[model samples]
Target: MSLLTVKNISLAFGGPLLLDGAELTIRDGERLCLLGRNGAGKTTLMRVLNGDLPPDGGDIMRRQGLRTALVTQDVPADLEGTVFPIIASGLGEQAALLEEFHQVSRSLQSSTDPALMERLAQLQKRIEETGGWQMQQLVEQVIRHLKLEGDAAFAHLSGGVKRRVMLGRALVSDPDLLLLDEPTNHLDLETIAWLEDFLVRRDKALMFVTHDRSFLRRVATRIVELDRGRLSSWQCDYDTYVQRREEQLEAEEKQAAEFDKKLVQEEKWIRQGIKARRTRNMGRVRALRQMREERRARRERSGTADLAVQQGERSGRRVIEAEHISYAWTGQPIIRDFSTTILRGDKIGIIGPNGSGKTTLLQLLLGRLKPDEGRVKLGTNLEIAYFDQHRGQLDEDRSVQDNIAEGNDWVEINGQRKHVIGYLRDFLFPPERARSPVRTLSGGERNRLLLAKLFTRPANLLVLDEPTNDLDLETLELLEGLLVDFPGTVLLVSHDRAFLDNVVTSTLVLEGEGRVGEYVGGYEDWQRQRAEQIEDEEKKPQAAAEKVQPQRPGRDRPRKLGFKEKRELEALPARIEELEAEQATIHEQMANPDFYRDHGDEVAQLQQRLEQIARELEQGYARWEELEALEG
Candidate 1:
């Protein structure tokens, strides 16, 4: 059942071997996730499988009649067609027989040839097998799933949209094998979920490389790891992969430690025995040297992820706030009468659909975007830095060192003004790569460059937009470690499930279009709410239930309610309204230009206090509803 048997595959870009003697055996209906650090030949291996790139040394034996469609990251946006026409490319194999019929009809009119008559029947039969005119209908069904039905020009769309269109084109073809490289990179959560279900139910074999941990867990049944020029498979999800890889590494470490002890004992004994080198001693000495080399190699082969986040200055309670802001583009609203706040050291994860204006909201808080209707205000003591997908602030033509050091009067490392070369070296930038242009650096490297700049400046508040994109596994781990321990306030907008789970302190669910629903806890709590919401959606809500269902008493729950409790419950809704009104007043003040110009320092503090009040107000409302339902 092995559909692809790639034996001893070797691929190289220029000098170093990108993939050295790699081997893979993939069978039909196998779902594989390919993992490796950046520049580890993940994309290259996929190219080799899809026949876009040939291996320098190795025989690839593919089963006959095996067709493949690749949703590559580099799927050229220059596809010479409109969005509708590009999707129509999926129906390429079934060229209509109309032209053939027209030619044959003309020829038949000229001469009644028997050979021409037979050719016409064969062409008609082939077209009939391909579903005739129904191929376009199939194409429409698949492309609609991608949500690009009425798009005018594929070429003029954003990078995310074009990626979607390309994926639709590849997926609609119904190939025997599918190669998806970072397939979920540009997709929203709903689209990703749809893709996962499709992959799970598909009959075709699939192999993809993606950083989305949740997507991989749902889609992949097998894991393929490539490291140090070798391939290994794990028949488990990404979560299990992490668990098993750690366990295996621990075993290897223990074995290595035991070997080292034996080597040391032998080395010590050998040194103790000879000032005079006898012929017998010489043989023992040579054996000990070889053992030492093996031990050294083993120690070096182990991988480690390390990080050090410098302690930040004490920040005040007020962190970030946006007030009564309304923004629009092309006469359509993105954020309307929107107000939100984050407290000191708050790690908030912003979630929304791709075009629902998550990035624009981030810009509004970062002082980059101006609201048409209302002014923006920030705390006086707050220091902020942002990370986005494009890494736009980086000078594309400049070197890594130059990009990092730009505009800074002097960069101090260990209390000295660091030389440009040395600064890049500290960030793990190789010396030879110091002179390379910024544009030449890969996605992962550019992110690292941005990190270096951020840390050197060392802001007290960090606003990150899709910070997980293009970061290698090692770098991501290092970043997670730093973010966990850092004292700075963080407002993150990311599609990366694992990253949010690991680092966030709260979740901001952008539901009801662009409106914000704040939740306590982190990604775990958000997931619980989402599940509850989904269940609510599926169930028909009864009017009796809407009255308010009784739940445990506040945080001090499970107590029996008396007459006083009943009266208190009746008054709770009014109190909730009062808190909401107060929050509105604070929001209005923060939005005023006078407040920012004269009382900038007090503005952030007021917002933080307002957030605490808002949470209590929401809880009160929920409690009131619960009591009302119970009474009904």
Candidate 2:
């Protein structure tokens, strides 16, 4: 059964119609992915479906009492208070009572005041009467599943966590149809994977807009595209959809060409003087008029972005070298004793969890932030262009053209001069939009604008931090191709798995506890190597145990421990305890804010000792078990 049906939806703004007779039917258990170019009305259609914005003309029929929930791309600025109450607010009418009850319960835990006790009892009775227990349970369940702290302030959370909280709020409603826009925008690789698993396991229908191709392939059961104010349904996987959509566009182009050829012939005949007009049939004349109207009404597809990188003169062979670099922030180590040599033309990808200091690492390499311990050396004649994840280089109050050309009418790229408007057109920006303020542009458009701004400058090195956030897939693939073919060195920091796999030649992964591991390939290659390393580590103890207690043929009795072995076994527990005690002391010291400020020189030495202790404890426990089994 269909949960919702949209018929002949027509929506228009001042300039053009955003949705012209768009039709859709969302069925149960359907996971649909909405795709389009940057400004092709994908988000507008989402708003229309959620009923937040009504279409100018449309009839929307819903299953009786059906519920729908929408998670917008940007978190609301007004969402304040603790996480529990914020999420419980999704329950509508029962939210206030639930929040009051929760507050009273928590207060009674610290104080035995009779007033608090009475309020709690009254709130519980009202909740029971209103059948709000299920809603409360649902709120708790969502908190646990999302791994959110109920008491944590929503405003204090990171962008990724805030997105998750928003998702939890939507999920708490238990809606039959869920709509998500750019769900994977700020999420890291680990969180993206978790969300993928969660959505795939979920039973409800989903309609979402995303630029992450990997997430689209994993979660979408069907693909739908909004192009030129029309909705197209592709009942296949993402790869198949790409192939079929190309073939479709080709066929449409061919058909349009034939129509134009015949229209031209008719126009030529009609333009002939009175001689032709005397023989012209009335029906053919009306048909020719209709053809002219049809041609005028046609909405041609927008052109793709024409992206190019301006390469600077080649730098020296070596690009950057870091020897045993260590950086700490408020006593917490971001990178410890990490060393790597980056040569020219090395496309290195930096990846880690959000707040794990990927940006800090980039700053360290680019000589922006000084390392506390070791040194970062730069090669000669290096020219660098950086694309910040926060889009800090863009002035929001400035017009798009002014931001690019800085009030100049013309700009130079690679020794060639072009008008600013003409250059912006290559990035799909019309003259009017180019004159608009940067704040008015959409996220994808802002990203494109940033690329346009960045590519204008000549650079021997490119550092992109989360450049794929709001780009359409076509633009993203185009960027991948550009990076792969660029002769300059590149350092990219991104959470996009597919982008990393396609562009980077190596990866710098920030494992926890200040460990940075360098791998030879992209995201998947790193995963394979890490898995193999773990498998090898797990087999080491077993292999040692087997080697120590080799069995002879026809031997029925187990070997007893020698005197030295007994002493070593008896001493193992004390040694393990001593190691653990030292480890705990080190951790306590590291947690103090003043530790790094006062004893910054000793940070690396202490970290190395802690690692050594961990290894010793592991070996001691393994040996003790082996001896105990032999004695038994």
Taking all chains together, each candidate's TM-score versus the true structure is 0.73, 0.83
- Score candidate 2 by TM-score against the native: 0.83
Give the Å shift of residue 622 in candidate 2.
27
The residue-by-residue lDDT of candidate 1 on 1-632, one tens digit each, is: 89898899888777567777888999999999999876677888888999999989989999998888888766583575567657666656562353353355446555545566566456545655566434544455555566675336766787878888888877767788899888887777667776887789888899988877777787888999987667888988787888998898789779878988989888777766455445346677888999988875442332343344333455677666777888888987777777777778788888777777888888887778898876677765776777767788888887777776774545764345766666666555766777788888777678778777766664778778887777666678778777877787888888787788889988876664446677776666787766555434433233234554533234333323344457788788789888878876775664454554455445436645654775576468658866777565
Which stretches in model 1 have alpha-carbon errors above 4 Å? 95-129, 132-138, 149-151, 251-312, 406-428, 512-514, 522-524, 530-541, 545-632
Residue 164, model 1: lDDT of: 87
When superposed on Cα atoms, how far off is each prediction in RMSD? Answer: 17.1, 11.5
Error of 1 at 332 (Å): 1.8
Give per-residue CA lDDT, model 2, range 398-462, as digits (tens). 99999999999998988999999999999999999999999999999999999999999999999
Provide the clash count, candidate 2: 0
For candidate 2, the lDDT comes to 0.86
* Clashes within 3 Å, all models in order: 3, 0
